[model samples]
Target: MKNRNQSKKPKFIVISEQIISKIISGELLPGEKVPSENELIHNFQVSNTTARKSLQEIESRGYAQRIKGKGTFVLNKTEDHHLVRTLGSIDATRRGFDEGLKVEGFKPKTIVLEKTVLDHGVSAEISGKSYIIEGPVLKVHQLRYADEMLLKDETKYISLKLCPKINMLSTDLSYFKVYEDKYQLKISDIKQNLSAIILPPDDPTNNFEYESALPVFVLDSVVLSRKDAVLELEKSLYRGDKYKFAIIAHPEYNGN
Candidate 1:
């Protein structure tokens, strides 16, 4: 049995997590100044020491650094080999880079390789549920480039029942943006699996025509709507040499 009277997380820890979430979501880009200690104190209703501790935690964790008299600034930790990518829960659903690649001073281009509508009879099993393909299912295949460098290949299967007009929308834009902006749909959750594989030369997915021995990271994902209905299935392949991934876990919380 779980304890009914567990202690809550410390105020400083909670404040640190709030800022970290923004960092992970790319809401706070590298070199941007984080909130000052006074801001944290006022916003979180904590003491000066608590706020200072929170900022210290951020710096110690390598998310930011404090320069005397200039306040703290976000660091581009992704440049380090170990922290190239982060995939986790967030309020916004974004595909490749969070915010935009341009924030990093690179002009990223998203190209639609293919777009088509699939008829019924296509089905897949996820979490023990059989999801049958209904009429006019929208399928999109895309390739992304940053500064003219190949980055990733992505394929998406969107249920027409959820977004019937998806086929009419521009495939060059993010699907989450289209769902929210055009259809006014809110994505509530995501289920994903990550694995690495070396593609054979004859494999159809070797669309980019990479050398046969190159390894890639395959990400399988399902997007869910507010009512827990499946909205989209996505398979994204990322170049392993150019990217790495990290997982950030939050403490398990019990309803009070």
Candidate 2:
């Protein structure tokens, strides 16, 4: 269970903490049954509404979910991942992803964003190679829009060995989809580093427009699998105006 010291917060918050604790403690594995509403009420000395509300909070926080007749069940929440973090097979409809990609430009070519490969002090478990992924990280530049306005300019890196087809990709395709559907790889985890920098190769804005903009947001991450295999290390610059990120913590099972 997550070791959270007790605090005199709202009852629902306290209950939520306990639920998180249990998941961390391993008492509640993914798909495990949570206490029924009646059990929760009796155990917590709370009302039915409060119990339900606690469950809702858990769900909203990305921890648990309620099935039609099956009661509340633990969800398999992903460890927050980043750097073109595949909002993996999301409920796109709800998130407005159904809005569709306005492909302003899709080009696959060699971009040397990083000049040299210094040891990142990390090793891949799958291959146990000392270097980042066998070759230079190929940066795929993408400019997409949901509507008329500029959406995001993406510079994603793919290891040459893991993604040889990337060199031949003629048009824009969902990078994650291609990896999963064609390559049979699943992005199980991601670690990200986000910072603000004066936008360089990523933004479409010319020097004239620079006066009105804030610094760009840079995201660097190495994606991995459940087996600790480093899939790819990616570095991307996002148009600070067009991209926003949200993170929520929930109880989840991490592919044990």
Candidate 3:
């Protein structure tokens, strides 16, 4: 049982949520200066650490960006550069990246940075389900681009039991096609979770060159075959400024 009277959220989170609501409501525009630590401390009557953490929380969620000497500012959202990607019904088959981008008149490309075969199995939890991929899995690190613009930095873990000798395939081709065409595996469904995150400045896996922290969409995905056999696990970082996801919603009816 949980305590009903206690506050569930921390002070920093509360402050950050308020600021984010302002941003969403157009009270704060892109490139506009955000409240500094001192301003937040004075306005909220909170400590310096709490104020700083609040700002950090906002930036981490892709709502704001900080300058070295200057104060933090709202991240610029360019409608022209944003590519709208529609997410269909959950049971509908997913489209390949190449096909989706091509339909939008953009040339898609994948550049493999590294590939390795692991000795032990990889374990992951997706959509409340736990899965352990057997040993001899293939690990691939790659960058995905649209025309000349970088869009995604992706890492994939593939079960060799389902895709044996997949390391020998051309890294440039789409794995989704290879799974169905070459391996004769029927992909049943894909499970994914998306969240806004900031890539650390010093992270070695970060291939993007940016002066400040980079805001991205971290997409965790699990690919399944017929009968719920796990085929692959992927962690992909999509550039927040370049991509926008659109999903359709239907209202549920409760009989009156």
Candidate 4:
């Protein structure tokens, strides 16, 4: 016979996810911080020990960091933070580099019902089943430069339903950091797509076409979670002359 009282309860991750999502939904703000240990204990109906464990884990993962005098501090706010690109480039991870950001624009445009269509003049690069993920998608575009050299231009689209509150987001705020805390949506894996492109006179930004013969590098990455849902579609283009992407991959064995 089954014990009626012994119900398999949900994990702390589930509770933490709900609370964090509310935070990302702008129910919580940057540098605003979260509840104290005691408040979490009462709110989640969990023990003090369990609540502490949840907060500690989230803080450890760079979603938030504990300060000595102050309580836990959220990391999303852009206060001259040095972050890396994580692409297959050594330059991507270089820290302490002089960087600056320009707020191109941040307005809520009515996203069309369907997905993306690459307007590149050349051949259709991305193949079948890789065009776009299924769901509400919101796109964020930015141009990144390494010091005086124009490095790359990036366009990232995240699930809209999961991030409806982004219209109020600032340059200091980070979407991935917020999602990790709120949805417990870990970035379990990422797949990358790379291609080369030629510059033209009327391209976006349309500046500094080298007199030499060379092409730019375009990268498209899709991030997925353990739940098998698509997190974000990131497409970026880089100046090949200024940056070089270096990676070492080895094949294990042939059919032995």
Which residue pairs show collisions in model 3?
none
lDDT of 3 by residue, 35-58 (tens): 899999999999999999999999
- Regarding TM-score, does 2 or 4 come out ahead? 4
Residues 161-235 of candidate 2 have per-residue lDDT tens digits of 566656566434555566666777777765666667775443564321344555567666666554665656655
Q: Candidate 1 residues 1-256, lDDT tens each?
A: 2233222667787788889889889787665568999999899888999999999998888788786776786766565322245564443255335333433335578788889998863555555566555666788888888667667888888989888877987776667877777778888877777889987768976865776667889887777787787788878898777776666677888987
Best by lDDT: 3
In candidate 1 the C-alpha lDDT for residue 15 amounts to 85
Error of 1 at 23 (Å): 8.8
Candidate 3 deviant stretches above 4 angstroms = 1-79, 87-95, 248-256
Q: Which ten-residue region of model 2 has the weakest summed lDDT?
A: 98-107
Shift of residue 11 alpha carbon in model 2, Å: 33
Backbone clashes for every candidate come to: 0, 5, 0, 3
- Model 4, span 64-136: residue lDDT tens: 5565554654445334322223353322211111211221111112212223422221111243445445454
The C-alpha lDDT values of all candidates are 0.73, 0.53, 0.77, 0.52
Instruction: Give lDDT for model 4.
Output: 0.52
User: Residue 12 in candidate 4 has what lDDT?
Assistant: 57
What TM-score, over all chains together, does every model reach?
0.65, 0.44, 0.61, 0.46
Better of 3 and 4 by lDDT: 3
